[model samples]
Target: MSSPLVFIDGDQGTAGLQIHERLRGRTDLTLMTLPATERKDVRRRAEAINACDIAILCLPDRAAREAVGAIVNPAVRVIDASSAHRTQADWTYGFPEMTPGQAERIATARRVTNPGCYPTGAIGLLRPLLDAGLVPENHPVSIHAVSGYSGRGRAGVEEHEGPGAVGAPSFQVYGLELAHKHTPEIQRYAGLARRPIFVPAYGSFRQGIVLTVPLDVRMLAPHADAAALHACLARHYAAAAHVHVLPLHQPGDLKHLDPQALNGTDDMRLSVFSNMEQGHVLLSAVFDNLGKGAAGAAVQNLNLMLAQ
Candidate 1:
């Protein structure tokens, strides 16, 4: 049989460009993309999506929805890199290590929704603890994350690096309204009964993210401590190739975490730092926002779907 055709729609944006780079020169599948002139032609775009065996969409939420709606081929599968379908029941979430059998679910799914960059970190840290019942469902959870400017896509790049851009701030925190889109995804996948407070920030760097969720030991399930939380996450991701659970930190063992440490790579590191005397525990995830958070994740889900 001929090689399966893979189409990347909207490959001009930041996420799209990175995904194209990662999948370029592959021998297993036939890569396809429309000429720049025809990229926005609705008919042409629809045709390209339907012609491929698998379509990877890296577009804005509305455009991603439109692309999926235009698919007329019954055999065409999709991996959407937008927030459009993440909370939808019919779409399979594409975080392979989120839980047992999640990878298999993506492999067999016809429509898969790539998790948001921030949600990827938040859910990665929260899911296992919630699943193990070490944390109460109604605990007041607050998440804080800082990501490279690339998380804002091409616009951010232009603001920080383009000509005539000279006075951009070094750091800025957003989502002050408490209605950030990733909140729902984190709550649902992390299995929380109540909504959590999510605050995200953008740094001047090109890519990477450090997302942290602080917890109060006194509010957790009885007998649950920092060690139990660490062990639970360690056990959950024991066999996961992409997700790493770092050793629990002791006093004076580690001082700080650099968000850009994982730039250019798809691996994500999860760290648990605690102060028992103060009854405080902090969970953090470090990864390239453009890699594991976006393009890397889309490529990952694409690989799983291709294995079917």
Candidate 2:
């Protein structure tokens, strides 16, 4: 039999470009992309999508939805790298390490929705603790994350690096309205009963993310402390290939976390730090926003789907 055909629907955007790069030399599958002149041609886009065994969508929310609607082929499986279907019940979430057997679920799924970049880190940290019952579901949770400007896609690149880009601010915070698109994706998959306060920011760098969620010891289940939280995360990701839980840190072991530390790799490092005296704890996830956050994640999901 011929190798399976895989098509990338929007291979010129931030996430799509990275995914295309990662898959450029692969010999196992046939990679297809429309030329620039035809990328926006509706007939061509629909025909390309309908002809592939797997279609990876890296488009804006509306376009991604429209692409999905255009797939008339019953055998054309999809891995959507957009927020359009993340919370929808029909689309299987593509974060394979999120729970037990999740990878297998993706391998067998016909429609998989890639997790949002921010939600990938937030859900990665929150889900394990909530699953282990170390943290309460209804407890008020707040997430703070800083990602490279690439998280904004092409426009972000233009704002920071294009000609006449002399005065861009070094940092800026958005989502002051507490209604970021990733919030529901985080809450739903993280098993939270209450909505979370998600505060997101973009640094001037190209790509990577450091996402943190602070916790009060008093807010956790009885007998649950920093060590307990660390152990819970370690246990959840023990067998995970790409997620690593760093050894719990003592005072002065590490002073700071550089968001760009894990650039260019798909690995995610989860660290736990605490101050018992103050009854405070901090949980962090460090990874490349383009890697695990966007393109890398889409490829990871693509591999699982290919295996089946």
Candidate 3:
């Protein structure tokens, strides 16, 4: 059979550019693109979408939706790297290692929605615990995460790295309005009945993220301890190709957790830090916002879909 033809819908944007770069030189797929003059032409865009064996969408939520509406060929599968369709029933959530058979689901899905950066870490930490029944569905969970400025995409990059940029703080927190786009995906996929309290922040750098969730151990079922929670997470991700669980024995001496530790690679590291005496535990996940969180993930899902 011939190599599969793949089209990237928004190939000029930050995430789309990264996806295009990652797919460069791949022997199994052919990358298709339209000329700049025809980039916005609806007919040209629709034809490209329909002609591909797989289409990866890295546009804004609205544009991604519009691109999907233009696809007339049912054979062209899609892997969307936007906030759109994340909660839709017919679309498969694109975190392949989410469960035992999730990879297969992504491979066979006609439409797959890539998980957001924040939700990638949040769901990675919470899903196993919730599935093991250590945390109830109605539990009040709060996630505190910090990302590099690249998480803001092109405009954020221009604001921070541009020559005339002004008033850029070393670190800042947002989402104070309490309604972040990733909350619904986190809540839905993590098996939480109530919405989570999500607080996100951005730093001076370009990429990577650190998502931390604090939990009170005493409130857990059967009075579980910190080690139990660690074991649950470690076991769930033991076989995963990208997610890694750090050992719990090395505590106190460890200095700090850097958000940019995994900037260029498509890997996520999860660690559990606990103070049983204080009855608290902090679960942390570190990854590249543009890698495992976005473009790398989209590529992974595309590989799965094409394999099918």
Per-model TM-score versus the true fold: 0.99, 0.99, 0.98
In candidate 2, which residue pairs get closer than 3 Å at backbone N, Cα or C atoms, i.e. clash? none
Please give the distance, in angstroms, between residue 240's alpha carbon in candidate 1 and its true position after superposition. 0.6
State the lDDT at 284 in candidate 2: 95
- On the 0 to 100 scale, the lDDT of residue 207 in model 3 is 91
Alpha-carbon runs more than 4 Å astray in model 3: none
lDDT of 1 by residue, 188-254 (tens): 9999999999999999898999999999899999878999999999999999888999999997798
lDDT (C-alpha, whole model) for all candidates: 0.93, 0.94, 0.91
Worst 10 residues of 3 by lDDT: 247-256
All candidates: CA RMSD in angstroms? 0.7, 0.7, 1.0
Regions of candidate 1 where Cα sits further than 4 Å from its true position: none
What tens digits encode model 3's per-residue C-alpha lDDT throughout 1-308? 79999998888878899999999779988999778999889999999999999999988999999999999898999998989999999999999888889999999999999999999999999999999998888889999999999899998888888875677777999999999999999999999999999999999988999999999887777756788888999999999999999988445956789999999999999998988888888899999999999998998899888887
Candidate 3 lDDT (Cα, 0 to 1): 0.91
Top lDDT model: 2
Model 1 Cα RMSD, 1 decimal: 0.7
Model 2 deviation from native, Cα RMSD in Å: 0.7
Runs off by more than 4 Å, candidate 2: none
Candidate 2 at residue 50, lDDT? 98
